[model samples]
Target: MDDLQFLDIFRGKLIKLTLKTSSYVGVVQRINSNKTVLLADVVYVEKGIKVPGLKLFFGHEIVNVEFPGKTNSGDRETLGYKLEDHLLVEEFQPYRKSIRLDDDEDDEVVINFEVIDEFHGKFGSAVMHIKKQRLIGVGADAVEAFQQGRLCWLQIATKNKVYLFDILVLGAQAFKNGLSMILENKHILKVIHDCRVISACLLAQFGVRLTNVFDTQVADVMCFYSETGGFLPDRVSTLQEVVSLHLNVPSSQLSSLKMKSQLTKEERELWYKRPCPLPLLKVMALSVIHLLPLRLVLLDTLMTDYMDLVDSYLSSSYNEPGEVEHINMELASSQAVPFFAAGTMQWRHTPRLDLG
Candidate 1:
């Protein structure tokens, strides 16, 4: 594969790209057959800046493209240009898995879990493969478990340097946090940061239209409202509350489970700084582990109250009739089966499945 292709490596990253005639900076929207497209949010010029809706640069016209990390010049001239109206984006609908009968594939499948925590400014995402009560993590401590073949079945993203998993952008809300954080209290920033990363992980991609993937908070809300059958008093619940209610694990026990770390207040300033202490890793690791038990109880709850949850989801009236129809289509095609790569998984008798 052409790993160096600017379109492939930095497909979704915000970039400062220099063309032969002018320099433009924006999010790399997509890489089509012939052109590299950008949502040209900002245009830099000698006198001032401009906000052009969308700009496309031919593959050959692009002279050079630089990512933020590589550009250390610290030029103030290049950055986000303030726009009058920001885009209002809708929440990403959760992916649904579909089942198909294929002799090559087995109906029995392994359960995969991932948890992401934000420390300092960086994201720490942990992955685990579970089957028949066995859990194998991808980390230094989990190596022995892997050697024992506990994780043998997992179709790991890595193979011949190309990762099968691709990063999928769930919503623009994830990118809009900075403005909201300034209005909110700094004390809560850490909590907000943690929650955002977790939300991102829920929407993270291993394969296209990932199935059996969930956010603990979303699952909890569905289960809670399904049981109560009313509008949620609190749209979002704290992680501690979900743990207490669903897993029957209290916050105090979770606190005790975290390993002790030597990180001082000064060092704690940069939580992602390595080597990440054992205590911090333990806490991060525990968050992933907690999801395991939570999934068990919540999954059962969801199945029992599936219709109630559907009613709750559909109850929200959309402004446009087409919008409602679109949601119905998305919900109808969603599957709950184990998801692998896009081509490997196929929906059998999709028309019958959707109608049902």
Candidate 2:
């Protein structure tokens, strides 16, 4: 298989590509967009086409973009003429999983969970073959993603070659790490950092970082080294530190004894600035209640005030359609299960069961 052509996933959503071969700069409107073909706006010397500055004097000509890394000197100079600068962009979305298509003989077939689990045994495995199929299916997706060289470029040079423990995975692990630092029942600044990191990492692929009040490496994760007292400390241990050490993680994990503070009771007033329960969880639960076709307002969110809020603001509004699905997905993830007794019930109905 042509690994190079398979680089479509690397084809960014809305990349700002500059034409290397031409006299004028042309902006790449979209590549790997959901549309069948890409649309680009050229600004240089082209005619006939109407752009603010560029005209398609000649018919459309396909200009190539050089991926940021690993370019040879000559090619770099040619593509370099366009210059490298950050551009606003959107992430590419995969086609819906429910869709089906004609198969190519050489195409590697992947099995999704729903298909395998459809038949418990006769078609599935003897000792839970359906589950085994699902594991294989998901692994295949990861592998196929790798086979196409689409693994996160950030982690490529790292030892494990896996994306950093993302917030979800990190949060799952956090419970094991202990609640002294983070809490499952609440939204910690660290958790917000995780969300930002995941989103930033995705955006960073196109060379972007959404700078906010949170420091680099996140507030909770940063360590500090004080010069005056010859000591090291946690950046988020106080609000004062939050103001000063806001530039990414403090120098390093270790602090020198030369800058030690003589104070005994380490006070941290502003560390946990917002003591908020996961209200977003409530939003999430209500969404699942709305989206899941189950005919039950019997769920907790179905009965709660959150339902009213979602009805007016989000759950009711029709989106133009795209990555906005992530918001819905985040909402569904908020509360894994809802309500009590019948309200919390989640299982296949007994009507389908054969008593015999």
Candidate 3:
């Protein structure tokens, strides 16, 4: 509802962003103990772009969700995945140099007496300036004009007050620089501690929890969210493991591994012929891929199981009328199939076609 209320969700938890450029979005809600609902609002895509719509269906209601846009992939970028791959080997990461984590530093620059008195009552004033506090007048509105992420948001006595501040950088990297400043500061640990408290409070406020990627079982941890209980512990895997791990069983072994059926042949034939699945199915597929570990099963076994899981998840949705069906079905479609090129287009259509 209110942005301040959202702060409650982040009060005491740690925000694990894949990149410094990213800002956290999404409000946590609950329909089942198994998972928390996250609503994404105020997406930060680009000046003229908009994110696609997302929706969830309850008994007779459909809930629309908006996710905030990210400045970067955060941790994923740090890991050198995709476009960030080239950056991993570089010598100058944002963390390589000085950092500043002081609340004093984070504190508003004391407005100069002259400017403070001039703006007092008339406009309400707060300066987010990196300028000398002795200045006659300065305020958060000034800092915001430059879009300083480090400043969060500058508040004056009045919300309508306008102050002037200049941005140190032009775009996403500016946010990174701001966060890096926080990371490198000598007081970083303290700020981080504060961030944790803030995160935890936020989660509790939003009725959600912030999960540590490492604590959750996963090989290559990309992203995660915690509602009351939105997950299953991943297989104990580390970043080192994700980077180096591969299917250990020899290709010869795969011949012996029978792929399990996911959808029944009827369903499979129907899905295979489609251009793309319904969004609900896609989300379900993502849940399956993220939560299920059968990706290592022999291709044959994988195929069979995927068919079974999908069919069950789909058929069961309407089975119990008005039951408020809420399920977290998982699919291991990606790891179960080999990659191939289809004409001019290249796609990783795991047996079930891994779109994400």
Candidate 4:
């Protein structure tokens, strides 16, 4: 039987769903007309840990389904633990809190956006805020803006505040003030998704070299290889895909954001407009807001699940022998390495050892 037929049979029963990225076990609560399955009381199967909240899975995401056997109604036990255990419920509450890009909806994050233009005061304070933060999320709009001989908006996000720098209005003054110093600083950790375009633009136009970068794209590729022991050099995941996989952001929300952020020929011209549209500015801000939190989640998984690969990749980035041991200690203790240290490292092929 196909996925829909299989789900129909297993309604209200405990089953394990094998998805492309991860596995989950839960009761089939409801099946929508669109072939989407609502799973209640979900437990992340790989870690054998229960996660609070109901999870919705699309038909395309279900790779395979296995009946895990009848659920014990007396004590509500499955996999040797009570599904309603109070202690376990409290422990998994934090996992449900995810970074949201929605405007004015997320109370957990204090997202403040400022338009830095000619009238905006000196950029020194913004640089000071960045230097004070342990981690920074950097994003740019219209990656080809520099190559096309135009200006792009640059977004820098800390834990609470997001600064949207109007490069067009500020011109070279923005970089001269302090942008170049931070971008080239090797000590401050900046989480950027796919730095190739940004790196090229900065180097060519501003005469600044981006250093100490944590490329989320490369990190995702590493995580994929670790899980499957398979490497596809040609496969590069989009930002939307990565966010969905790691953060569990709903497909509908991502689809809406994607539609809003699309830069057609006409939309591309908006970047050069004197007063950039609010909708477009919001999109740019939203892009980088979740990056820092996403990095934490990815790093936690990498350090726990694939330490060897982490060691190899991180050690390759730094030259000092002592630095590697220090980083390894941090990983072992589940501490986030504040900086990438030396140079950015790409994921390289490593031979898989056969345990059997």
lDDT tens per residue, model 3, 295-356: 22222232454576677777877686566356675644554322223212232322211111
Q: Candidate 2 overall Cα lDDT vs. reference? A: 0.24
List where candidate 3 sits over 4 angstroms from the true fold.
1-177, 180-236, 246-310, 313-356
- Which candidate number would show the highest TM-score if scored against the true structure? 4
Ten-residue segment with the worst summed lDDT in candidate 4?
Answer: 83-92
lDDT of 1 by residue, 1-356 (tens): 66346546555566767778787666666667666555433445332333434677777888987765333232222342111111111111011022121131533232222222222221212121111112111111111222231110111111001001101111223223321222122232111111333222333311112222345666665565445543333334555566556655544564523321233444433332222233443343333334434555667788985665566557644445355543332342235332335223332322111100
The CA lDDT of each predicted structure is 0.36, 0.24, 0.25, 0.65
Q: Which of candidates 1 and 3 is the stronger one according to TM-score?
A: 1
lDDT of 2 by residue, 230-349 (tens): 122312232122212331223221121111212222221111111101221121111111111111111232234455556545643455334334334224332332112421333222
Clashing pairs in 4: none
Q: Please report the TM-score between candidate 4 and the true structure.
A: 0.56
Look at candidate 1 and give me any clashing residue pairs: 96-334, 96-335, 97-335
The 10 consecutive residues of candidate 1 with the worst lDDT sum are: 157-166
Better of 2 and 4 by TM-score: 4
The runs of at least 3 residues in candidate 2 whose Cα sits more than 4 Å from the true structure, single-residue gaps closed, are 1-41, 44-81, 84-356
Q: Among these predicted structures, which one has the highest lDDT? A: 4
Could you tell me which 10 consecutive residues in candidate 2 have the lowest summed lDDT?
Answer: 155-164
